[model samples]
Target: MQRTRHWILRRLSHLDLILLALVLLLLGISVAVVASASGQSPARISGHLVNVGLALSLMIVMANIPPHLLSKVGPVLYVAGVVLLVAVAVFGEIRNGSRRWLNLGVMAFQPSELLKLAVPLMLAWYFQRNESGLRGKHFLIGGALLAVPFVLILRQPDLGTALMIGASGFYLLFFAGLPWKIILGGGVLAGASLPVLWGFLHDYQRERVLTLLDPASDPLGAGYHIIQSTIAIGSGGLFGKGWSQGTQSQLDFIPERTTDFVFAVFGEEFGYVGTILLVALYLSIVARGLVIAARAPTLFGRLMAATLSLNLFTYVFVNMGMVSGILPVVGVPLPLMSYGGTALVTLLLGMGILMSVATHRQLNKT
Candidate 1:
């Protein structure tokens, strides 16, 4: 009986209980907010539950796998992700004026989701392989690798996902010892080229920026998202309108409330105080991730963990900024709090990698 119990224990994931519990709590919050956003639609709520369930299961499976094995898989995953991005550019479906999804017969999905993990892992693996003697050209090669996917995703016109991917790669590169001179130079160059880049933006994308600057310019058009979301948030005050009692959400004034703008629903229903707690929860999760990154024994583990943690931070920051009328709405979801399968799965997969990094080190020590 003891032997059988031991075998069962061996098969279980070495999950960081704190991380697991925090994410689960966040997921729970997501369901409640999604319920309010969807007006308690049973189908939407049930479908969201299915997605969360499936994503959590994947997270557990990924957590059990060691970082070394993930390192070996990084290059292959990166290659596949790039190939799919190219395929998406060539034969992807056009939805909401963006060619981001590829039809796989069984189901259609955005290929760019793969890059959320592949980019960081690939760069970490690359730097680790060349760790003994790194040089400028190695950074160049890594930049080139990062650029290919970025350009491909950019061509798909998904500026949000593309920029997020770019940010993740930048995080990985920075951790892999990318020099600050290049970072500064690149920033200056990017600023100088803003006029040139503006021409490349889609009309709607350009309008989003314009509306962000002055939401009243097109109150019923491009400016609607910011105007409505801010109203919802402000109306909530200290304790919020009380869950489903939010006027903006219940009346359907907010767009994309279940996805990109879910944070608005949260802000309205929970208020400033609620949002504070939410931010604290998010910070707690990031704090745990930083601990894991700091403690990981290998460069690959450390870089990957740090990148994932910061990427999650990016999600929270960008989404809040968008909803609060501070930044242009880039359609970034609010991490585990938003309802979506692809992004949710990608986030969970990254957390799984973090768990592997956290636990496998202890396993080796034992």
Candidate 2:
């Protein structure tokens, strides 16, 4: 029995079992919450489960990839993402006044999702190559690399995805030790450009910001989502009304209850206690990812792991804030908890890359 245990441990030494456990726990919670939120829709639950399966399969595959091979392919993946984004601009299908998806005969796909991983991967690879002497000009080059996809996705009018992708790249640059003077100067310029930014916002986008400031102004219109979500959350109290028993969701008052507002569903069903548990699980995953990043042997591995972890943090923070009415609705989904295949798959792939970094380093050390 001792020899068997030792053999198993040696075989699985590369895996971050704690992070894997956290991921599984979150996925379990997501499946349950999605089932409750979907109500009578059995297909929704099955589809979500299928997505989880596919995502997990991909995660395992990516976790086994060698670090050097990933570095070599990073630029290729990024270039592919850029090409897809351009294709969407020229020959994409329009949905609800936004050209964000490309219909490829059998299926429609969003290119912006690809940038979420590719941007960070490419940036990490770039900085890894220039690790010895990164200067102000190199930072400028990095910003330009970040801006191209950011602008393209923003043109797709997917502000949420564009911002998410841009944030991932920015995290790498910041982690690469960008100077404080540049950070302060950029902050000042961003503040000065506020009016210009407002001018560029679409009417609906502007309305979202206004609604965030004063949701009461359009309670039944623009502010309806926030109002209903908050009501659901507040009514759940300390112990909740019970699984699938929330009146707001069952009565069809909460909007987007399965996607962006799914957290609200979980909150209403399981209340404050459940929310605390879920948040802790999320933080554990983030913390574990950071530990892996800190232990990474190569600069590329460290940057990628850190950026991916922070990007996960951004998703959780934005989704919770949007649902709780603290931030403007940006359609950011709660990582792992939201019922969307694209975002879920992209996120899992990133976590897999982090796992790859950790495992690859361990294998090299052995």
Candidate 3:
């Protein structure tokens, strides 16, 4: 009992209060959005609350792990994530025209979410192991590892998640000190491959790109969501319409209001001021994450932490852009504010790993 108290005190001192406060603020905002978006669906709100509780518990557990242990386990976790993704490809349940979830009797799991963390973990471990002097071969091998799971996820036709995973891995490569010329060359190659990739996209995928090019062409078809979302955002003006009072959401003009389109709901009800405040909260989280990454005790910790931080930013950017019609509709959720068990869990787990890095740095500094 005495030893337990001592250990608790030692670990508790490392907690990042600012990050936690921002997280809680986001949670508070999420509850409001979920309630408004769900309209009388008590079940969804309850489920989200439960998921948040579970995720927070997991974050606490992750924060307790030592940096050395996290580094050692990174590869193991990565392999496990990859194996699960493979299993999902072979024997997964298909939903909404995509085979992305694995049923575990009681609940469904998305392995792609696991890859968001695992990719960074694996890359961090690899780069740290080979950090003495990286080379072209090392970059090639890293790209291959990232491409394997990315290809598998893309085959699942979950473009949003696949893109996130790819970004997470790419961040590690960038942080590993890859040359600017190589990076530019890779970008040029990707741009050149667009035509080939376009030829292979599914019908709906093609429609989305087309809609993005000219949203007014199909006002009631592929363009309905963006048009509606844009209206909601514009109507909010500067001060917003007030909570639970946005006509677009209240009248059900916005599809996926509680999920992908929640940001629209937020914009309609809270307006530009609300949007700015929300952005500030996200910015705070990102800033804290960068600090943790910069002060991380080792190369692996720094890479993993930075990748996770940037990945969170990508989630915000992509989701907001898609809902606003600046980007095509891909089913990316707005981090904690969106209602989905799998996404909430994945987000919280990523935060856990970030907290783990932050905790490690604090311990070492002491």
Candidate 4:
């Protein structure tokens, strides 16, 4: 028993307890909400459980790896991710009107998911190398690094995932001391280019944006999702409709309840106070990640940890906003809570990187 305990302790020494606790709580809540959202489907609930286990296992594995080793691997991952993305674009399966998934004979997955990690890793590696001679040119090179994959994913027409990749890369550049003038200029440039960008959006994409401005205009058509989701959330009141008793969710009014709109189900079942507590829980996890980033012993570790942490915030914010009718609906899933093996794995993998950053100093001591 003593040796068994020793082995377990040593193996898990890299985990940050606070972050783990928060993540567990989030995952536990996810299981319950997924049950409700999925209408007590045993298959879906079991699959979610399997995903949770797989995600946690990967998180542990990543936690045990040293930050220095990850720094070295970042560029390789980035290159490979880009190559896979090209393969996906050229010879990928078309699902739901987008060519995002690559079929590798025996298995298939989205390469954009890998870019969620690779983009930041690549930027961190680049910035760290240019630490001493940081200049406008270096940021330009960083932007170029980001634009390649961004264009590829956007061409896949998955604006949601593409935006996420862009956000992660931007966060990395921001942390690397990107100038405020440059940021402001870029914002202006983007805003000015909106007319051009609008012409490029697909019919469905354009409808989503229009629907956000006013869902009632097309209540049964383009606005159906937001309309139903907002109703579900509003009907929850203070204490909620009570667990699986949510009418909108249980009656299947809310679309994609198990994934993108899981928050709506949670709100309906948990209520106003429950939603507040849930947000607090999410905030706590973000806080812990930021703490780890602040304490990371290396520049690469700091940038990687901070960017990944903020990236989590972006996911929550976008999903909630989309479900609440405040933003255009997109395919972004609620982190750790959405029901997908791929999404769960990629998200927890980032958390694992957080643990790796948090525990690096301790690892070096031994």
Candidate 5:
């Protein structure tokens, strides 16, 4: 019994308590918001709770694995992700005009979701392996590696996810110490190419951008979502109208109340005070992730942890921005708060990676 206790203490000492606490806190908030948003739908809330539990379990298991093992398998996993994405493009199921899912009898999944983590992991491994001798050519190669999956995803027409995948890879590149001049040059080129990109946008995509510019222009048409969402937020004011009593949500005035627009439901029920507290919680999670990355025992671990952490921040920012009408309406879900198996699984997997890195830090110190 004494020996078993000692072994448990040794393992516990390596656990990332702060990151775990943030994950649990955010998950608890997710359950509350989902319950309110779903109008207290028992089945949906229970499913989400089960998913969160699974995610936490996965995180604990991942935290115990060594960083080197993760790095070694990164490339193989990335290739598998690409193959899955390609397979989806060929024979995947289509829903709502996007062929992004594979129907696997018992469950359906999106390969693009896997790329979110796979892209970062693969790149981190690549950079760490090649960091002994960095060069412009290496940077360009990394950019190409990043761009391939990104272009494929964009062709799948999942712009939101493709952008996220690109962002994750770009974060890895930026941390690998890419040159400032190249970064500036890329920015200028992107700015200059906006016209070309705009020309190629699908009609609905164009309308989304226009809606952001003037939601009132098509009050009852393309702009209805933003218009309704803004009203929900505005009506909430300070302390909120009270949980499960939000008229916007209960009346179905706010579309996607349980998914992409879950934040609106949260804003309506919890108001500004709740919003501030929620944002603080998210920031704390990001901060803790940054700490883990900074203290990571190896370069690959550092890069992976930092990129994953920032990816979470970006998810929150983009989802809130799109829902609030500050940005073009893109179908980005609010992390754990949003309903959907793919996103929930993907996000939890990311947390798992963070836990792995944090655990590595603790192990190396001893």
Candidate 6:
């Protein structure tokens, strides 16, 4: 028992306790909500448990790695990710009108998910190399680097992932001290191109934006999701209706209740107090991530850690906003709280990188 205890303590000596605790809490809540929302279906419950285990394992493995090694491998991973994405575009499987996955003999996977990590890694590597000479030209080069994968993803018509990936890259550039004038100018240009963008959007995408602006316009059609989700949240009141007792979810009024809109089920079952707690938990995780980023020893580690922290914040903000009808429905999942294997693994992998940064710094100090 003494040996076992000592082994465990040494293994977790450099781990971020606050972040890990928050992750476990979120996972627990996810399992509970999924069980309730899914009517405690054995398959769903077991599947989620498996995903949580796998994600935790990935996190642990990543945490043990050093950030210096990750930075060295950044370019290789980025190139591989881009190649896989191109392969996806060329001969990917089409499911539900989108070509976002590649089919292996045993299973299918989405290459776009890899970009979420690779993009930031690659950008961090580049910025670190040119740390003393960052300027407008460098920013332009970074923009071009970002644009290649962004265009391919946009063609896949997965607006959500593309936007998130783009945001990830841009976040790094911004943190690298891209000028405010350049940011303002780019923002103006983007706004001016709205009409061009509107023309490029698929009808369904446009409808979602419209529905976000006013869901009542087509209450039974394009607006159904937002309407039902809001009703479910509103019905929860101060303390919620109780677990497995939410009418909107139980009776099938809520769409995508197990995935993108899972938070609605949580809100309906847990109410205002529960919602507050969930939000606070997410915020606490983000805060810890930022703290880690602020303390990272190297420029690459700092950029990568901070970008991941902000990216996580963006996911929670966008998902909750869409579900609450404050933003357009964009198919963003509710982080670890949502029921999906790929996303959970990817997110935990990023968190693992953060832990690696912390661990590497500690080792250097010793």
Instruction: List per-candidate RMSD values in Å.
Output: 1.5, 2.7, 1.8, 1.4, 1.9, 1.7
**Which residue pairs collide, candidate 4?**
none
Runs off by more than 4 Å, candidate 4: 1-4, 362-366
| Residues 176-274, model 6: lDDT tens digits | 888999899989999999999999999899999989999999999999999999999999999999999999999999998989999999999999999
Better of 4 and 5 by TM-score: 4
Query: Where is model 6 more than 4 Å wrong at Cα?
Result: 1-9, 364-366
Residue 62 displacement (Å), model 5: 1.4
What is the total number of backbone clashes in candidate 3? 0
* Stronger candidate by lDDT (2 vs 5): 2
Residue pairs that clash (backbone atoms under 3 angstroms), model 2 = none
Query: How far out, in Å, is residue 235 in model 4?
Result: 0.2
Better of 2 and 4 by lDDT: 4
The superposed Cα distance between candidate 3 and the true structure at residue 170, in angstroms, equals 0.7
Q: Rank the candidates by TM-score, best first.
A: 4, 1, 6, 2, 5, 3
State each candidate's clash count.
0, 0, 0, 0, 0, 0
Q: What lDDT does each candidate get?
A: 0.92, 0.90, 0.88, 0.92, 0.87, 0.91
* Per-model TM against the reference: 0.97, 0.95, 0.95, 0.97, 0.95, 0.96
Task: List model 1 lDDT by residue over 29-71, tens digit each.
Answer: 9999999999999999999999999998899889989888999
lDDT tens digits by residue: candidate 5, 1-366: 999999878666556888778888888888888888887899988888888877766766676777888898889989999999899999889988888999999989888888998899898999988978988888888998888889888887788999999889888999999889989999999999999999988788899999999999999999999999988988899988998889999898999888999999989888999889988998898898898899898888899889988999999999999888899888999987788767887887788788788877755455
Winner on lDDT (4 vs 5)? 4
Clashing pairs in 6: none
